[model samples]
Target: MTTSNRCVCPDCDWVVDVPVTTTEVFKCPRCGHRLGGGAPVSERHTLALALAALILALVSLWLPFVGYSASGVSQTMSLLDTSAELLHFHERLLAILVLFTVWVVPVLYLLAICWIFTRLLGSGPVGPVTLYFIRTVVQLRVWMMADVFLLGALVSLIKISGLAAVELASGFYTFIAFVVLQLWVANNVSRYQLWHRLPHQQAPQSEAGRAAHNQGLSGCVCCQAPNSPQHKKCWRCGETLSLTRWRGWRLTLALLIAAALLLVPAHVLPVMETTSFGRTQPNTIIGGVLELWQGGDAPIAIIVFVASLVIPVAKILTLLVLLYVAERGNDSTVKNRVVLYKVTDWIGRWSMIDIFVVAVLVALVRSGQLMSVYPGNAALAFALTVILTMLAAMTFDTRRFFMPTTK
Candidate 1:
């Protein structure tokens, strides 16, 4: 019930009091974004989970990942081979993307969480270093895609099982455990609790239960703490606060245009080339989907279609509509628009599933003469399309949904 429990919603800029002591889930009254409030997990417990996940991630890297046997020839792929093979074919950017999303980002995120929570469990004040790590955790959370990569791995295994004997290896189980623990740690580590534990300076006098911008305050994008307009850095987390509001929509528009332009090449060109019995076949995204469908793997084909085709195009179109709405100063469907933006941001990362599938196939199905999978031009183009659309969604400021468009 402390009066300092005031916060500005990052999504819609709604100001409300979210007591650190509350046990019920809190949502922004204006836009339905989760604002805080839940049964809090202990800092020590979160630290332990993070440490366990880190160990599993390391183990997964060292062990053999999967084994494939076909036509009396066999191959075993280590976890790193997914990216290493991509690099062997000169797909450096895609390789780096696969490596970071599946392994590096998750490990770094767990490390940051362990550091922050370990400090919180100690008897000392949370220092600047811990604060910085907390900021890192927030930013890295979205980019940690071990779970998506896991699904992609499963899909790759399914696609290849008919062609060969596929065996799950020790690293696969270890990675599954790591992904589960990492998700648990992510879910239980409450950002509100972390920010609450940090010491806060006296906030400038402003009424709670109103829009923060109306009172000459801006919400910290990193920590959601309301800051006075004059401050360039957040008082709580030291994140830079943007003074301008319109730049976000402009940047979002530019990125969307780039992504839209890339979609044509992504769909038209071959994503991966398959060679079997000395004959080569090239497949585009849609062509692959049709192949999977005709091959009786309709479920996976639908997944690939939705993730690779429908989602990206839908996201771009939806974002374009949102930009139009923001430009026209429409506020009637503001809540709906905010919800759409959230969904767009959340699902954008899943589009990379196809890219991961290609990486896995390229690495695992390397039997020369009998069969082989090679990275194609469309793989990079499609990857870039997904990335650009994701960036566009991130650049889009949801607060624009609530703000008035100026002439």
Candidate 2:
């Protein structure tokens, strides 16, 4: 029912008048979901920040990240050390995930955004290549975790400071700067403006037009290009289009259940084992937090407690509630449910802090009984739980919540 100046709220389906001014930010009145926001950063500034980020990324990878010295032994690790150490220990899946998050995805994210920005700043109208790359950047940005990796590194440093002389190596500070600049770029650069400037050459029909044209249109999952019910492929991006948004509900449920089951051993079993002078102690997630609390690192303890314990539980419970509500066809709370889903999806990856901490410890603390740390069974289980929950969030189609309820 809405026209060019109005859009159906992604959260609630309420028609919203698009804000006019560069300073005017709009939030969905019913759900408080941000409908739109402020102006785009200047192209020159965004491009400069992006290039600086590239430099910092290289320094982060090339230099020694941090070092530990104790009992006449000293060891240092670089950014790649985490994945290399995991692979050396035959944890192939973890190594791949870490490598992807820390290296591959972040690089791809930076490059893809740079490419899109270049196109936006150029003389010619934006093409399919630019649109596809922009969409790709959106997907890759969520999985990039250099910032989380740094947090995990700091927590790991605090945990081992008592047992070893821990030094923040050059790469560590470089990584800190890199993370800050990266976030600045993300915040200052507006994707909305970029999308606006693009020619919309092959974009699917407007939401209002599609609905009025035929109620049977399917939205492309990739570029959101609307296609007729008889069409198998999206007209704009060529992605497959399907009418059944609920097609994979069962798979989402199954993954959620598996993640919940793993959350048990993830908390119950030891995540890391430490052996010092022939005295070995295994610490589960709760035990580790308590240890930090008893050791006077209250802040770090609280952080660990929230990241390792609270986040996983909250993510699982929240997703479960959302799935149930979404499947139930509740009309009134639809917008609230979308807000909840977004929050749950965003925070699920941070639960990997425990796993990252274990990786750094396993790699850098290999002193022979002076202090040696090894990955425990719970590390694998916990990592799997995080991965499963992420998958579950992705499998859930948020558009389903926006559908009209069938009474």
Candidate 3:
């Protein structure tokens, strides 16, 4: 294998040859991470989908997203209201988070895609600005949560359906379209193809079919380009490369510790308070799940339980285990450990579903005495816990799975 076809697996540190002309899906034999050998979607198609999604997003903003009527009182909520109402209650941080994840990030991602592909279509070279936009696109993909927010919105509606008249509006349908188109664009957009189109400086000569780390090389987290450990930045995308294999796990451990501490209050305190006919009841995370279960919405209850309780606890514990495995240099099950890290990283974001539900309910349910919902202290704590766990997983260097013993 030569420099042109050699690629390093980001998850397992395995070096493999990837042919440019192959159309079948490529997977790392060591850890099963997708290496992107499928037929690439055309830049024109991706650009068009992105533009369409942007239009739907803009339209969804001004239109009413959900409408609720109770005791002759009706309330209508637009998509932006979910975050705006949080601000009204002085949850500035939560409001900003919800706004960014649901609206701001997706819009920015779509705009970045449109800009990058437009430049590509013009046959222009990938300059610094285009490279910056490309990096932004990749980073913003995980934060785009319109689809998750949609599920939370539906759950919010279900929680109040028996008490009032609930109706989905034009904005809801438009957002559904936006989420679908956005996912289509995300799934088909190929980072491998994007970087291949750009120019890359020659890498130092290294043997093929061996771990890049063994040859003093590190894979760029941003562009997947192999870089010499001595180089501060990647030759392809200019992303900063990690110089040492043993770095980051200490920080990951610290974050996991903090998240574990916060998990206590996140479960013990109420996530939201409900008021009905001058009566107020505060519901903790598990309390809310139990309410849903006893109300005959067992499926939604199960969904909430897993997403809120099971996933977070499991993710924290799993990351701790991975850190221990990495430190112990247990290469016997490195492959399985890599897969576990990927699963935890992917599922960690879904834990925010409960947060989104709180935001939606706080914004959508408002009626004097008849019924109303207010966010609780646990809302922010739980949000922080989820975010910390996500950062912990990100800070964990997967390459350590293939590392020898660390002193």
Candidate 4:
């Protein structure tokens, strides 16, 4: 059989015929995935956007998402305040996760992008490490997770709609804009070009290495070292590093179904209970938002509604649709599947907004039990639902949507 002389561009998905002459450099015709081209950024642009993303991230951490008022009690929470609260309430895990996802990771990623852009603006090729850094930034781009927080916030708002008095804060809008800029920058930066410009180091040749490489069977994708080609396990790490797609569908499906079952009680049970003077009222998500609205914080009501209710459910539904399409091998659903995949991927992290809001309130809204905030069990369940469903959705294979229709 003749060799199938074609290669696929990992970045842009462009397919090109490999030239018969090995001397000719094969490049992607669409993205020009060769070497020696700088990204479309000037030093000034890189510095400016970096500064903006940094500023926005910092500002978001210190501003109030919404103000809470009940029975003549009132307060506000900033992002950092919430993180501190999470640590205080023994929810340190979620708080740390929030801090890194919302505060630290985005800032670091943007900084890395800026550093690379500033160094390579008009200069030539960068070093291999820097190129690795660029690839890392690209890897991290989708996982930054602002949208997930947003969705969670919306879901929480909708759930709280009927109960509490809530009002929007300046920080809420700032956070939204922060998510937008991150997405804009990530989408605009071409990874293919970025990787092409970075220095490429060929694997060092050795007698044994050459013999293993020439045998052309199995190895690590990262180090290009050969392994047990016969046994389907890497000799070095005992890892199955062959080109095998993950095969955990039964397990993933079981966990997801379990989470889906828990989602019922998570939403049905009370998430928060408030007491004032001698009166006590248990609040579901719907009740809280209505209380906030009736208390004359209409904007906050809307913010809470959108961030906590609408977005989370939307994200969940999006994920469900994608999973269904993928599992069924529905080629006709490919476009919709892709759209849902993008949506779920982009917004998975924003679900943390409710977690942040709760965390901050639990930390800062303390008044010696006279007026205090604490997370209820349902809050934990709800948070878990959002997190688990998002993860399940992510583990779903979208490429299945593109497979040939066999059934």
Candidate 5:
């Protein structure tokens, strides 16, 4: 329903007229405020586009992103081919990560989105099972990360502009489609609405259910508690907690620490050492940036340095500060704490700017021995560190950052 300079309350079906400037916020007249009363995503076209995206993604895997030729040898490379090349160069760890992030994970995420859209299309109120599916979709939204891969390709291209050449392939087009579909889905889907429609059941006063409830285990998103072992909602709050697939911050923290340690060596060591005839040169991230700067590419150098060096360090420090304050119960400055949380949350993924630059360089600079560019082990490790730490920060519950004022 189109509002004439007004916002409608989805809960009460009350249409409240608003001043033109207030169109940005959807405030209700009767109930005051509601978080998400946005448009529904039941459009037939979204589903069609989503399906098309999945097909394109599959085609991209088989087709090459671009073709390269050097020294009388020429070949086309798919996304998987790049990973294979990395593996061939004995960068086994990088190969595995690229395979997962670029080839496997995106595929799975798209497939899952397609399945969710299909289930939702046939629907009245989606059952508890579908509710779980919606949750999974939201969770996958955080980790899908195709844009980062695209960015890495872009970065790689700029690094070796003076050497070699690149030609676009069918796969690049498909990858672009994949990114568009993801953004579309994110805009249209309403997680709150999907879960809210499911029926609620109170938890039994029994000892087992009550104990589990107290321990934050019994209730989940879809079903009301006091119902059964399979009950979805809490007997108390009725707020949907993830019943089975709850994310663990502890494991995420460990992974981030391990990934960070690995990143130190990944950046310090040359990702790919180029050997032309008898001349050889190894390029670390710093070396690459310095070379770009000296060659009059100051803008690119600044961007790369900020993404590669400064952003990661800032993220690490921000997270450390948040964790420290939360642990110490420092409530003296609530506003500053909130500001830090917002900043940390927003900037966490900008680290992928370097990844984008890397991918572009790899695609553009494919001259084999004369000017070949390959993501060294450090690039892979550094990428993983960013991924892991971002995951850690997301799961770390910033609600804990704001110290409790009341005793």
Candidate 6:
């Protein structure tokens, strides 16, 4: 192997020897996680995109998102108004969650990116503040859900179109532009380049010590940088480190059990109850999918059924099996299992689409008796299920599966 650098795998803690002359991107030998890619992003371009994203976000939030009209009455919806409307209906928790994920988190994340880029691209010395900004940006990334909110709006538009006339507003188009810029910045931002540019500090562990530490090094879950085992937080991103390697089975197991329990009511109970022209009807997750299917929205129904129903139950089962396997000392197939873990982790976020739909419908359709929507108990239950499954995935330790069989 032609080699120039070596690093511990973030997922499995395998000591990987990277090839210097190879033309391909490096992936972890054990978990198949992408270690690094070709050519670092230029400081100038990354900074430009970050600044542009912030500007677009400001523009998007201020413009009216959409308009609804029926029975000689009309109303407008703005990006921030969704949370306000949700709050009016006494859905305090959903209101706060929407306010954070759709509005506050995205703005804070963009600001953090701009702050980091300003310092890293400037001639000024990057001290501990760089680490602070890096960590803040990482945490904010998970909470930012502007693009996801856009998808929810699309679903709501389709759902409400049959009952009322709908029109896209300036904010709707502006929000799409904001989402595009967000994606651009994410693709161009390079942690590898930024880490290299930060002021050099001595690794607490000597070269021999790092070698001896081997699989013991703590990897920053956010930036995936390997840090000394002695540190309480990541050196690169400052993310809190998980010190123990006992697999977090207790926490993970508890979350999975909670998620499984919630999943039952989530499917059985009504997710949305709508009243139109003095007639009331309730729709559960499966019932809504079938309703959509009967109404010639086979594609959309399939999407909702898979995202809200199939994915959650599948995630629960997959996590449970993996937990049992880990306890059984099956270290083989770590790579495939890690891949499964990634799928479960990423797909959990999309399950929020239904929750978003409920919020939108309740907000958009609330016009005294002629047409109105009230979220059923199942919406909260389903949302909680999504949250629990995501936590379970986060708490699970993939490294333990690859560790040598314990005596």
Top of the candidates by TM-score: 1
In terms of lDDT, model 1 sits at 0.86
Candidate 2 residues 198-273, lDDT tens each?
3334543454422312344454554333456667776655545553354367888899999999999989999988
* Tens-place lDDT digits, model 1, residues 1-407: 25336788888787777777778888887778887888989877888889999999999997989999998989889889999999999999999999999999999999999898788888899888998999999989988999999998988898888899999999999999999999999888889877887776667666777788888887888778888988888888888787335348778899999999999999999999999988999989899888889989999999999999899999999999988886455666777788788898899999998998899899888645599999999999998998899888878878777777311
Give the whole-model CA lDDT for all candidates, comma-separated: 0.86, 0.74, 0.85, 0.57, 0.58, 0.74
lDDT of 4 by residue, 22-126 (tens): 333455454344312233544576567776877888888777876766567677767676567666766666767777766688888888887777777657657
What does candidate 6 score on TM? 0.89
Candidate 6's residue-wise lDDT over 1-407, tens digit each? 22334455656765555544444677775568776655666667877877787887888777888888888878777777777777886778888887787778877877878888778767877767777887677566666677778888898888778767999999888889888888777666655445545433543432321322354555556655567767778665566766444348888999999999999898899987888788889989888788778878888888888889899989999999988886455556665788888988888888888888887777777655477788788887898998899888878987767655422
The lowest-lDDT stretch of 10 consecutive residues in candidate 3 is 1-10
Give the least accurate 10-residue stretch of model 4, judged by summed lDDT: 202-211
TM-score of each: 0.95, 0.87, 0.95, 0.64, 0.74, 0.89
Q: Write the per-residue lDDT of candidate 3 for residues 257-370, one digit (tens) a residue.
A: 999999999999999999988899999999989989999999999999999999999999999988887746565677678878888999998889999999988888944558
lDDT of 5 by residue, 79-178 (tens): 7666666666566766666666665766666666677667766767655555555556656665565677776665555555454455668888888887
* lDDT at 124, model 2: 91
Q: Rank the candidates by lDDT, best first.
A: 1, 3, 2, 6, 5, 4
**Each candidate: RMSD:** 2.1, 3.4, 2.3, 8.3, 7.5, 3.4
lDDT of 4: 0.57
- Ranked candidates, highest TM-score first: 1, 3, 6, 2, 5, 4
Q: Candidate 1 vs candidate 5: which has greater lDDT?
A: 1
TM-score of 3: 0.95
